[model samples]
Target chain A: MTPDIIYSGAGMVVFAMGLYGVIASAHILRKLVAINIMGIGVFMLLIATAHHDTLIDPVPHAMVLTGIVVAVAGTALCLWLAVVIRGLEHDAASHPSQ
Target chain B: MSPMLFVDGLLASGAIALALLSLNAREVFTSIVLFVCLGLLATLIWARLGAWDVAIAEAAIGAGLTGALLLAARHRLREPTSRDDTPAARRPHVS
Candidate 1:
């Protein structure tokens, strides 16, 4: 099989696995990890498609770069939200009243 | 298969394997570490597929930045055994 075909198939499988994690996992942090996994799978497929026998496509590479940045930023935001939420939970549990 | 093809296959399978392991790990710390390893393998995969730009970005941002963030978040979100009642915490309630 061609390199493109191999990676493309792998990418799909990875994406599906991530999707399963997002659905099945209970923790919000785990869900974020799964979401990042899904992004990686998509990036892999894009990179695979960008490569031909003897040629490389710059557009997809750029797209993947942007995607990587966005994914990290999104992860940070999610983590922040999770921390804030858990902090509130701890507060409520400890205080038992406003 | 050519050596290059075999190498490509190896990297592809490794990436998938790492992903599975990370997702299934019982501990969040273990999961984060495995996911970082997967990102590194993914960087190599991008390089193999001729995406040098994406490879660098994945290594630096995807693997490095994201792993650090997850670790910090995990620390912050850890189960609060500290929430157990010390006298100070109970003082307000008793008063």
Candidate 2:
């Protein structure tokens, strides 16, 4: 079998696993990890699709680069929100008598 | 299949396994660590697929920065309270 086929199949499996995790997990952090896994699968699929003429497609490469940056930004924001929620929980816990 | 194809298949499988492990982990910190490993494996897959630029970006942003953010957030969430314990106290329409 071709490398492309093998790689794409693996990527699909990863994507499916991530999907299941995201659907099953209730924790925000776990969901974030699952989402990032799915992102990696999509990136791998894009790279695999770009393999042509024994070379890679620059367009998808560029797009994946953009996606990496955007993913990081989004992750940071989500993490920040998680922190805020945790802080709120902490404050509420500490001042339960108030 | 070529040797390069074999290598690519290995890297892809490794990436998939790591990703699945990251999601399957019940401990939040362990999941974050696995996510970082998954990102690094993905970078290797990107390089194998001949997307050097993407590989670098995945290593830097997806793995490095994202891991940092997750770690920091995990630290901030140091309270031992269970998430389900205080749903009634939350704001009604913050979504």
Candidate 3:
């Protein structure tokens, strides 16, 4: 019963849940969240594996930090796009003639 | 059995539970809140794993910034008549 084993198993479950959400949800925002969850799961698994008895590896830590930054940027862009899309939808609804 | 392993187990389970609830919540707002919680729990997991760097990054960029961005977007979307309703084509260039 090591912490690594527990976190890795949990990561797999969370990743599966995220995959299911991405497949089942129609809303883009939900899909975005699902993607973030999936990313986190991958990060968890990576960090879980990087643990060593003697010394901790720095590469995975660096990678995860970069990943967090990239994820935030991607999420912000996705949210902007979603807002733009909703605005377009509202326009279409309001102006049925156009 | 070390007490630290016990804490790690709890955090792992808690994170998974939050992820499930976050994805399946009835409202997007609730889902967003749950997602933020998931991120925080994830931070704790990183700390337990001895990745202090990752823990701070997850807390600030992952949970804080992402949640704030999502909530702001949700606020904009919730407005019935958004100021952003002006169509792109209708707006004149600001040359």
Candidate 4:
């Protein structure tokens, strides 16, 4: 098999695994991790497919760069939400008599 | 398949396995660590596929920053003995 074909196949498999994890996992953090994994797989596939062009497409690379940044920002927000939820729980636990 | 293809396959499989393990592991800490490893593996794969920028981003943002956030959140949420009790039950009823 060609290198691109192999990479594409592998990317698909990883994507499937990530999808399965997202569907089956109960914890919110695990779901977030699975979503990130799937994002990586999609990024890999886009980069690999762009290699087919003679000059290599810059468009997909640019898009993926934007996606990476957005992904990080989204993760940060999710983490903040998790922290907030935990804090609420902590407050509720500590002031039970109040 | 070429040697490059073989290597890509191996790295890709490793990445998938790590992701699965991370999501499926019972312990949250172990899952977070494994998720970081998966991000590293994905970085290597991106490098192999000639996406150096993506590789750097994945290593730095996906793995490093995310891992730190997860660790911090885990610490904030740690309540070993309170695992059995629901958060709602721990709250005071403000009558």
A54-73: candidate 3 lDDT, tens digit per residue: 77888999999999999899
Residue A19, candidate 4: C-alpha displacement in angstroms: 2.5
lDDT per residue (tens digit) for residues A12-57 in model 4: 8778888998898887777778888788778878877877635667
Best by DockQ: 3
Clashing pairs in 3: none
Query: How big is the positional error of residue B70 in model 2, measured in Å on the Cα after superposition?
Result: 0.6
lDDT at B66, model 3 = 91
- Residue-level lDDT of model 3, residues B14-79, one tens digit each, is 989999999999999899889999999999899988899999999998999898888787777676
Evaluated against the true structure, the overall lDDT of model 1 is: 0.88
Give the alpha carbon lDDT tens digit for every residue of A1-98 in model 2. 36667777887888899899889999888888888888888877777788876566799888888888898889888888887777777778888986
Mind giving the per-residue lDDT tens digits that candidate 2 earns over B1-95?
57877687678778877886788786888999989888888878777777888888888888887887887666556546525356553423211
Structure candidate 1, residue pairs in collision: none
Q: Give fnat (model 2).
A: 0.86
lDDT by residue (A2-97, candidate 1, tens digit) is 999999999999999999999999988789999999999999999999999877889988888998998999999999998788878888887897
- How does model 4 do on interface RMSD, in angstroms? 3.2
Model 2 pairs whose backbones collide: none
Question: What is candidate 3's DockQ?
Answer: 0.65
- Return the candidate ranking by DockQ, descending: 3, 1, 2, 4
Q: Residue A48, candidate 4: how far off, in angstroms?
A: 1.5
Q: Please identify model 1 stretches exceeding 4 Å from their true place.
A: B79-95
Which stretch of 10 consecutive residues in model 2 chain B shows the poorest summed lDDT? B86-95
